[model samples]
Target: MKISRIVLASVLMVPGVVLAGENARDHFRDEARAATGELASELMQALQAAMQEGGPPEAIAVCRDRAPAIKTRLSLERGWRVSRVGTRVRNPLLGMPDAWERRGLAEFQARHADGEAYADMEKVEQVVEDGQRFNRYLRPIPLQGQCLACHGDRDQMSADIRGILDDRYPHDQAHGYQAGELRGAFTIKAPVD
Candidate 1:
């Protein structure tokens, strides 16, 4: 009778456990989106200011130097691992998404190719690694008019900007992009209890 009761209790708790997991996933997704938006806004503003003050070269500096600093600070403050990664990378330091991020980016690309709005492209998953569960979220980053000054057509780019990019990133693969194209993605990971 005791064994039967324990079995019944476990069966009854399954639904609640599943529901809790779903709720946790949703909560983490929302949190990731909010944090990503804030970080993107701050970075964009800083890049805009840098561009206005100098030019695309200065903006590159903002991306190369300031962006990592912002990611680090935000990660510490928000208790999440935050980063930007791309299929083609400009900075080697942050180049190449992990396996999970690669899958998310592929999905985003497929959705975009299927005519889905770039703004609507996102992926959130609960993954287990080393017996610990994590909530991983990714949102597409579409190229903008400002980004074209650096990441656009090679021939159209100013000589100074090209030179700077080549010098700073010897193996840069992040170019030849157009506005409205998927530039990369913001990826966030947070541990889940």
Candidate 2:
């Protein structure tokens, strides 16, 4: 009788365990999305202000300096690793994507190619590295009209802006992007508790 009772309880708990896991994933997804949105909004607003105050060339300093500082602050505050990465990166400091991020970027590109709206594109997963569990999330960063001032076709860039980019990032590969194209992604990873 006791054995049968134990078996019944185990069976009953199975569904609960599965549901809990799903709930946890959902919670992490929500947290990641909120954090990503906040960071992106902050960065975009700063960049826009810089462009208005100065111009596209001056905005390059924001990307080169301010963006990383924001990432660092957010990572420290939220206890998550946060960053922006691109397929073709301008800054060598933030260019290389890790294995997981590489996979996420490829998936984003594939989904975009399949006609998925960039704004609606996101990737979330549970990743285990060295026996540690992490919730990884990435959202596409679509190019906007303002971004074109700097990231547009070479011919479209003024010589001054082009020279600034060339001098700052001689090996830059982030160019020739059009509005509505996938510029890159904002990636975040939080440890699973």
Candidate 3:
């Protein structure tokens, strides 16, 4: 039966993954990338849908509301994370994860935003667990004329829009970012062990 074949295939794959020859870190990293891609794609769709349906306010609200769900699912499904660094807000796992803690996001912000240097694109990998690896993919979040309505200077941003950003993320560092300056990263990670 198809079910049996699928189960057999799944069982067969587990050993190879746990096998010593194959690097667990690389396996986890690859898995994490795939997972992150799927999650990010879904979230992007949700954001776009909110924009079309609820407008900008809805778009922002949807993202704010869904972040926790995303984090929880990532932890449960992959035993990993979907998180942001450089956030003044506290994350319980910020320093407690058995194999995670990378400043890739913080580094990007520090160099690009504070240090006044920006890269059009960047990808860096770090070992979070002995065999697991995490990658941070970054690109600039530029400001377009259209975006000025929500994210530009105070004079340009309407009070409602500013309030939205303020309400959801009181310690937001996402502001003051431009189209070509690195906003942050799309981090993909998995345990090496």
Report RMSD (Å) for each prediction in the order shown. Answer: 2.8, 1.7, 10.2
Task: For candidate 2, write residues 36-148 as lDDT tens digits.
Answer: 89889999999989999988877988888888998899899999998889877888678567888888888888888998888888899998999999999999898999898
Q: List the residue pairs that clash in candidate 2.
A: none
**Residues 1-193 of candidate 1: C-alpha lDDT, one tens digit per residue:** 9999999999999999999878877888888998899889999999999999988888888998899998999899988899899867887678678889888888888888898998987898878998998888899999998898889998999999998988878888999998988889998988877
Models 1 onward score TM values of 0.89, 0.92, 0.58
Q: Candidate 3 regions off by >4 Å?
A: 1-22, 86-103, 106-151, 188-192
lDDT of each: 0.88, 0.88, 0.53
Q: What C-alpha lDDT does candidate 1 achieve relative to the native structure? A: 0.88
Clashing pairs in 1: none
Runs with alpha carbons beyond 4 Å of true place in candidate 2: 1-7
**Whole-structure CA lDDT of model 3:** 0.53
Per residue, candidate 3 scores C-alpha lDDT tens digits across 35-114 of 65666667678877887897778876655677557756876886665543322222333312222223554555566655
- TM-score of decoy 1: 0.89
lDDT of 2 at 11: 100
**CA lDDT of 176 in candidate 3?**
52
